[model samples]
Target: MAGTTGIIGGGIVGIALARALSARGEHVTVLEKEARLAQHQTGHNSGVVHAGLYYKPGSLKATLCAAGRVSIREFCEEKGLPYREVGKLVVAVDESELGALAEIERRSAENGVPDLARIDDPSRLREIEPHVAGVAAVHSPRTAVVDYASITEAMAQDVRMAGGSVRLGHEVTGIRSKNGRVHVTTPGSESVFDRLVVCAGLQSDVVARFVGVDASPKILPFRGEYWELAPERTDLVQGMIYPVPDPRFPFLGVHFTRGVYDNVHVGPNAVPALAREGYRWLSISPKDTWESLRWPGAWPLAKQHWRMGVDEISGSLFKPLYFQKARRFIPELKSSDLARKSGAGVRAQAWGRAGELLDDFAVDQVGPVTLLRNAPSPAATSSIAIAEYIIEHYLVKAAA
Candidate 1:
């Protein structure tokens, strides 16, 4: 609390944390490997500001997302950024999904999702999403979308104004703790800090090892690919249409989202990536692939989810198969409506050596170094609140 603070990773979460710490008069410096911030998961996402519909009640995700969305709205207003409440509809296409949909409704209610409504009548569902096909659905009118990259840029500006340095292209290479000081090394640079917070999204686990932490929670890069709706087809989705997700899988299945810019896009089918930064199928890293395969958790995780793995991989490879998944929500959808592959993001999904997904936000500390072990999806939504939580529990209170 008394010396310079180093926050690794230049994504929204890291920048948000930097903004907070700098405002508190902590000398903060952000180290990002990319030439600019928001180049990874922060920039390449569905851009939906989640409404806490899927997270477990009383969980960190639920608590932070509830607070973070409000904070994000306020921040957008203050910064004159685009914040559109396009709403979200989670549909149960058939009776088989009704029970899962009901559980989501229960969770949403307990999580206090604003203006959440359960619709059993097909007509009511049509009123919200005219083209959506579903036996039942839940509507969240307050669910919104924003330009996260823009938001992150604004936060970075605030950090600079508050006297913190946002250093782009400064990838962290090594870290050493000695005599209560953290020594961080980058190519052609070395810096010492009183406290270090690692928010390295994709390389978080790798960096944690640099701090000499356990390697149990390994980062498994899961790539989510999306497709753009044809210009004429964008109107088919009024806001966002989603499926009642499979509880066993950590993904939300392929869905339609109307971005803050008013462009509708489909997908983000989850698939394993060949590299930690793998976005496209051709962007392969033999080393990253080998490491993931060699990890103790990899085989068990695959063994448990081989069926889902096969399904997702098939969808990733075949447009027709992917179209079938999306057409479940919108029966009128044509295969051609999926104009082209728009973009993709690699998620740094963490799993235990025992083959279980690390669901909640996890934080670990090693002396003066604090590591954000697992923070995916809703992490951008919960960034500011997460920073506050870390400050209170890890930094400020720890100092006291």
Candidate 2:
């Protein structure tokens, strides 16, 4: 496979790119460290197909997400997968939040979100979500839900059907560029590729450094913990209930999500992780922890967002507070409505040296290598469009 295109990471973005390349008659190979695909971020997210809300106008995230949602829905329909457009309500509980809600409406309109409406009548809002309490709300009727991990597996199958290999458990230990070829070394063997794309979510910066790229923006892992709604209280959330997000932070505040399978999930509070892959408070890695501390940006970022960070961690440590925060959206939801804590995912958010978290997706190319430097929240929603963007702008242009 010396002349093949190599892609690292088996998550949705990597697999989606592999499918796109193979569809174009290009020989592709995907290398994953895990034993199976979609074991991390792809499988652990809230599974909401964003309707292009909350992104800055004219940005890659805004454009790509707008296109990607349509692409995902089409793909799911073709593959006979579950794609439910149950809709979402971004609620504002008080007069103070109405301003933010209006801003979100403006951004959604700028991004071409279809059928978005501002619901000011509380009774009308209650008709959409019987239990949700908000003075005003932004109803996104097109916002849908799908199982991303299932979609990833389907994409992996397409890769194999197109004669490409999805090699699991193939951890990339080293990467070097020499004489116009990239050599990727593994535990048992090494393979050379004409071009390489790295989508190593948690270890993105570390992987980019293997090819001698600048490592200024380091990856800071933030764990998002969630709780499953009890079976009896699943009706508490009609579709998806979200709060008016704080402009200062990139994360959407804690809310209720009705998954494709009809299970309601309440949570995903963002908390600082002790390690890059740490999903729980007890899961610690000394090396990862030290690297975060050693970076110039980490301390300053902590200093800037310490209050929110402390609140998030406090929510994680105490279920009552977490329940209270979530209750803001659906005022009738009770502590007993939550079952045992569900799964958690670690976000590989990029932080620059200036202590600012990158708010958009970033891609960097070094000759034959394309590295995804920053891809968060909307990434899963934007994976397909991102693949098209990379191929049309980078791969196709390079070949020309």
Candidate 3:
């Protein structure tokens, strides 16, 4: 812990870790592949700071999200950044979804989600979200949103102030352990650090393989596409209107989000991306696609969730299908309200050989090289807390 630390990936989690370590007097350097930080998942997310709604009680997601919300809120206030506690309502659109909604409420309570309210009356649900349609809902008034990209940049500033270095365009090509030190090679640069932490986002497994690690828990990129609401129709949503996510899948079904900028968008229908960083359907990578197809878990995963995959793909290709799904939660929602395809973000979801989605935060160590194999979803919302968790559980042991 007293030595220099080199962090791979320049997303919020990696930046947060660098800041924490730097503040503790550890020499830190961040290597970002892109020209800037947060170019991938961090900058391309919904921006909603989660409030421990759907995660199981006592999970890292549940615990860290609770703590990280407060951390992010404080960070925003201290930096004079925009932080909106716009609240979130997980609605049960019909009687059938009530069971999953109830489970969410229970988990929220167990996770100590602040000021969680269960609304059974339709009128009460209307009071929370005027245009929303739902039989019952679980509302968390403390749920908030912030610009994670801005936060990551601010944290990088803190790292620099604390004598840390952030190097952009430093794509790690190879990694090896030499003489008890980790040597990371970029195209034109060869650098050794006392410790190296791989938070390499989409290329986590690829980087791990450089150190001769197992590729079992592979990254399966799933693209979440969003459609922006027309400016005149933004008022239809007050805060966030989410569906009772199917417990069978890790993805929370497509819902409405009133962003911090006050522009409401509906979307993020999860579909298999042809590339690790695949944003649009046309942005396909043949090698990435072939590797995914060749994975042992690929068949089992497809077999289990092929229907959901087809439905998601259908929504992705056709706007009308996507509109129908959105309109179910808001009766007044017009197909025309979805003005244009805003953008897409590919989530680097980790899956096992048996086709099991690694739902929790996962870490692996090969000597001084610590690979963050899986850090999805609330990883951004729980960034600072994740830094602390990683430091306490992994870094300290490695340093000693």
Candidate 4:
């Protein structure tokens, strides 16, 4: 079939992009490797609609995240989807981290986050979350919680309603550009499109290579493992709670999050994954393992942050250690309070050849193909804005 635009990967970004193009009366087709949409990172996130916190000022993440929060809420309301403005707290447990907390507050303000207030008194903290302990914190009223899977599903519905086709289990093996048309080859057949947008999250590098792009900044999958709080201890957390993140690391610290269903979950320790889709310890892929091990960016990242890696791996294996990290915020936490393993999500973290983590979202255009390389954390919250950006910068400008 012929389409004006072909979107690879049916995660949040791909679905949103397809919907946006189709809404504009363009013929769009989405190719998804999995039978269902959002089967990867989109489905496995904490579902927090961030309030533009923790991102560097004047960066794409800050701009998209700030605008995406509003767009997501409006989209959810229009679609009658479930979402909540439960708010969030970034707590500083020790005096040493107060400066970091202040920096986060400054960044949030620069990003245009509204209704932010500082809470330093223990009494007010108790009123918000009686179980949480912190010497200082920043209260962001705009932080929200939502079901990302539902949002992606709604985007898919909109795509179909706009006369676009979503092809499931159609994985592209190769891509070539010729005569102003791009040809995409899958195992079953070949498809053609005027323009191609590659939103493959974990496999973005591989997808870019097929179209003859350099595919720099290889994706290093970092598995974030989570644990659910026991049902009896759900009241310990009133809303979303987070620890002040270390500036050196990209992953947010283990924090408390209340899902839209009112169930509280704790965790998401960042550890290197053995496979791109490895959700459990026993899950391993030799091809993925070898590729990751031999990547030019892997060893330098390890050398620079070996201590943090060791700590994350230790926390992943030891329940007590995991509880200790959580206890910094909620002093009442106990090892027994943690329930059995729930599930894990692998973050598609991008590492440059120089061993530095890419702090902002990365997109590249070569000829007629556009590859969205690194889109992690805020991508879910920033889907709508990202879609518009892609349409403007990649589709329209590239065509011009």
Count of backbone clashes for each model?
0, 0, 0, 0
lDDT of 2 by residue, 1-400 (tens): 2257999999999999999999888999999999999988899999999998899999999999999999999999999999999999999989999888989999999999999999999999999999988899999999999999999999999999999999999999999998988899999989999999998988899999998999967998999998999988899888999889886564748878999999998878898789888888899999999988898998888888889888898889999989888887777778888897998999988999888888889999998899998888899999999999988887777667
lDDT of 1 by residue, 304-363 (tens): 889988999999998999999899888899999999999999998999988889999999
**Considering lDDT, which of the candidate structures 1 and 3 is the better prediction for this target?**
1
Worst lDDT 10-window in candidate 4: 246-255
Give residue 19's lDDT in candidate 2 (0 to 100): 98
- Mark the regions of model 3 whose C-alpha exceeds 4 Å error after superposition: none
> Candidate 4, residues 130-224: lDDT per residue as tens digits?
89888989998789999999999999998998889999999999999999889999999899888899999999988988977775788888998
Which numbered prediction scores highest in lDDT against the true structure?
1
Badly placed stretches (over 4 Å) of model 2 are 1-3
Scored against the true structure, residue 78 in model 1 reaches a CA lDDT of 100
Which ten-residue region of model 3 has the weakest summed lDDT? 246-255
Total clashing pairs in model 1: 0
Query: Which stretches in model 4 have alpha-carbon errors above 4 Å?
Result: 1-3
TM-score for each predicted model, relative to the true structure:
0.99, 0.98, 0.99, 0.98
Candidate 3 pairs with clashing backbones: none
Model 4 lDDT vs. the true structure? 0.89
Residue 292 lDDT in candidate 4: 87
Each model's lDDT comes to 0.92, 0.90, 0.90, 0.89
